[model samples]
Target: MADGAVSINMSAEECAIQALADRVMSQIADLFFAQHITPTPVQQQMLVSHVRAMALRSRTGEPLPEVEEALFEDISPDSMTLAQQVVDLFGNLPVEEAWLLSVHFEVAKNEG
Candidate 1:
């Protein structure tokens, strides 16, 4: 668990997805520590929730709803790189997954 660790109650069948989400959280936590970023509690909650959904999407092959590329034009390259690293762990997610995830990091980076 990271700085803003969350507990998610799930049925037995989804335990693996939970594990994956936790792993992602751990990596995010490490990034936060390494970069000296401290997200507000609310920001952390949103990031965690989004990470959980990403894990579910990875397992279920659910596509991310289409998002405009211009929407991410202002996101920092470092944040996008970190988001892409996390998305790579799933091995099956789309590049747009990184684009979407980058928003989370950007928000946290801006606010923290």
Candidate 2:
């Protein structure tokens, strides 16, 4: 786990989920670095938290609350593409997952 990562009680399965989330976040950090998108510490923390939840959802087949597509109309195509790529890492997530995740990337890019 990265420095400052959340500490939680975990069963064996939850530990695996945390490991998966850590791997995915490492890839995402590399992607952000390659793109010169530096999220602030707070933003990075939020992203990590969100990805942890995403990892659990991926493992459990949980669905996201419905997100309105129009809310993301202002998101850049690049952000959407990147978000979709992240969502694809989980293999079975819905498009709405991408849509929801894109907000984090979009915010980080804009605020970077």
Error of 1 at 24 (Å): 0.8
lDDT of candidate 1 at residue 25, scale 0 to 100:
96
Global lDDT for candidate 1?
0.89
The all-Cα superposition gives candidate 1 an RMSD in Å to the true structure of 6.5
Stretches of candidate 2 above 4 Å error? 1-9
For candidate 2, write residues 1-112 as lDDT tens digits.
Answer: 6787897777998898999899999999988998899999999999999899999999998888878899899999999999999999989888888888898999999997
- Report the C-alpha lDDT of model 1 over 14-68, residue by residue, as the tens digit: 9988899999899889988998878899989999898999999999988888888
Runs of candidate 1 with Cα error greater than 4 angstroms are 1-10
Candidate 1 C-alpha error for residue 65, in Å: 1.1
Q: TM-score for each prediction?
A: 0.86, 0.89
Using alpha carbons, what is the TM-score of model 2? 0.89
